[model samples]
Target: MAASSDAACPADPPAIDLRGLTKRFGRTTAVEDLSLTVGRGEVFGFLGPNGAGKSTTIRILLGLVRASAGSATLFGDDVRDVRRAHRHVAYVPADVSLWPSLTGAEILRLLERTGSAVDHEYRGLLVERFALDLDRAAKTYSTGNRQKVALIAAFATRAPLLILDEPTSGLDPLMDREFRRCVIEARDRGQTVFLSSHLLDEVEALCDRVAILRSGRLVEVARIAELRRLRRTEVEVSFTGQPPDLTRTPGVLETQDLGDSRLRFTLSGAAAPALRTLASSEIQTIEVRVPTLEEIFLEYYGGQDR
Candidate 1:
């Protein structure tokens, strides 16, 4: 008998379904009243700073920790039904650990046999692409190399859902590119990906939507476009003299004097108001651009340590 099956089951229910889920360790609440759903074939981003309950939510989904209240299910099967629920999932954590005595190849084969069905052809290609030395012992691998091993194994599996939490922690720029490519391929293959990362740019590029958590509670769930739309426009105007007094402008949030008769400020909502105000000034040149993802993320975190 085969150790695992690659056969995909019917996906009528969502890939992940959490309803009013909460977890508390005594008086400390790790995740509170969290309700979220990830559809089949959707790439969803899970974002939060440290101590935001992201890890606890993941643990509940994996059946590693039972939720104190509410429910979490995968394809309609309760996560508590570990064996059956696990059949549809593959997960890679930020820090990977393997048997020190086993060779890289052995570990790969072991994970395939124990976790999910193997995609042998894809596995071969990933091994080559990641440039992993399968003959070497796990104990000899560095942090980046260990991450590569786990990523290769996870990407080469036939699981219908993937849960990746900070999976690219120690990878270099070149390997980071490889990881992004694999994520795209996984989406093309109709896999539902739950990506948890501090890399806002990566999330912005790969995920269709994201759920943001803060202080053990769900703050928001929005599409990437919607999040970008919420950002204010950054307008930098160069004048013929001292900057104008647009601080009282309806849409301008803050202003900075860029010297050389230039002013930079953030404008939110409709630009018509700011534009009208700028038209009255002796503007020599004007530059308007949307804020970057990092800037937006900081806004969500209030520029605090995350």
Candidate 2:
């Protein structure tokens, strides 16, 4: 009998589920009390700074490394017993290595042997889509090209779940954009993608939800829309006359003169009061901009464990 689609998706379980997952390297605790849930077909961003345990968490989920405590499930099976479940999942690590003696085609063939069934036509399409030079030996490929090979092989599997850790680390801007497009297409095709990166802009652009980790602990998990809403806005104003006093404004955080009657400032908590202040000023030009994810990270991670 043929295997059912549920077998491919493993009971239609959440793509990733963890509870109090922890990992230790000798005396160093790499992950601590981390828990997260990623829904099927959702692009979930796992974010943190270096040594914050993001990679360790992904490794634990893949069963590449055992957890020191707690439990994790991928596709409804225990993380430690995911040999079958792994067939439904694909992983792209930050640092991808390919054998110098093999060609791109050879590497992909090996991957398919360990992964799900492959379609030659689909593989060709992936090669073209990723602009890979398959005829070249692995030793000839640059870092960015090697990353492309990894991405192509993983995505070509068309698995139900993808665990990508810094998958675009070596790509240029254009390739990065292309990679994101591919991920978007996969999500539309009902594939779940768990993306781990320190790049907040990437997270903001591709993720439906994000989980922030700090010093091996799960700090926050929120919808991307909600996190964007939580972000503060920046308002800059130029007055025809002296800049108005903003210290008394309810939402205003700080104001600095930008010379020639212009003032730049940041605001949080509420926007209404800031708008009112701007309206009352002898304003020549007023600009209000939302904080980028990087700016928000600096604010949130300052003096903290992230």
Candidate 3:
């Protein structure tokens, strides 16, 4: 008799569903047998390097491109029946396509008229939150300013679903924080956000779960907390005199010496033992730092610093 294997259960009323979704251009297979689900009101992050079919998958989901094989359902409606579900979903692309001649106010009015009723109060709040100068013409704004305009327009609406592709491309650090706040606010209001971005940190900060793709293949789907469990912490200890030998610590991966009476090493697991070890010694100071999303991104992509 063969041994039984654990089978993953299907999601209950998925917010977004793709089963065996495949796309092809002549001989090139853009996406192959990709199946995934996102729960309602969850901020799901799609992560991948350049040309990893991220855009292709998004285009198919938006009904902008036809899939060669398989099916997609957004909010329980068939992909072919997109118009029915599209009203609930709003998409912000990497390259915003606002009319160059249109003023910020004009573009906002147009998008609002196309979709459901505009939330004037929310729009005003977003303009102020993102620090967007609505008086400027679309063509005259800088990259960051243009990004602000797009963000304000997309987030101002009370849409149930938001599909943002590289949403914060040109924003400064402060604006990025504002963007995060907006996402959180939307999630709190029961809105589901599907974000595709190269900025892993933003994903780590904002997404409840993240799906990593490598070479058009889905490599990993993990929760933010679970992914953080896989993170390594760097411990730096400065000694009043000579450094104590930390060669025997169980989770210690490596250790190095700093010229200024300091030693640094990495711990693959908990920092409790490392802290205990340092406390026992005549340490002047100690610093512990966790791995950033960028570092984790490099590791998952088969880059160095593993």
In order, what lDDT does every prediction score? 0.91, 0.84, 0.84
**Which residue pairs in candidate 3 collide?**
none
**Alpha carbon lDDT at 236, candidate 1:** 91
Put down candidate 3 lDDT per residue, 152-233, tens digits, no spaces: 8778888888999999998889999999999999899898999999888889889999988776677778887667669777
Higher-ranked by lDDT: 1 or 2: 1
- Each model's TM-score, in the order given? 0.86, 0.86, 0.83
* Backbone Cα, N, C clashes tallied per candidate: 0, 0, 0
Give per-residue CA lDDT, model 1, range 80-166, as digits (tens). Answer: 999999999999999999899999999998998888788899999998988999999999999999999999989999899999999
- Could you give the candidate ranking by lDDT, starting with the highest? 1, 2, 3
Per-residue accuracy of model 2 over 1-306 as CA lDDT, tens digit each: 887766655356677889888888999999988778889999999888998898888888887899999988877878788786687788899999999989998899898899966657767887887788999999999999999989988887778899999999889998898889889988998989999988789889999988888788877798876665687677788888657878899878778888978899988777788788777778888888887767766666797543
RMSD of 1: 6.4
The residue ranges of model 3 lying beyond 4 angstroms of the native Cα positions read 1-12, 133-137, 239-248, 257-261, 273-284, 303-306
Identify the runs in model 1 with alpha carbons over 4 angstroms from their true place.
1-11, 239-250, 255-261, 272-285, 303-306
Model 2 TM-score?
Answer: 0.86
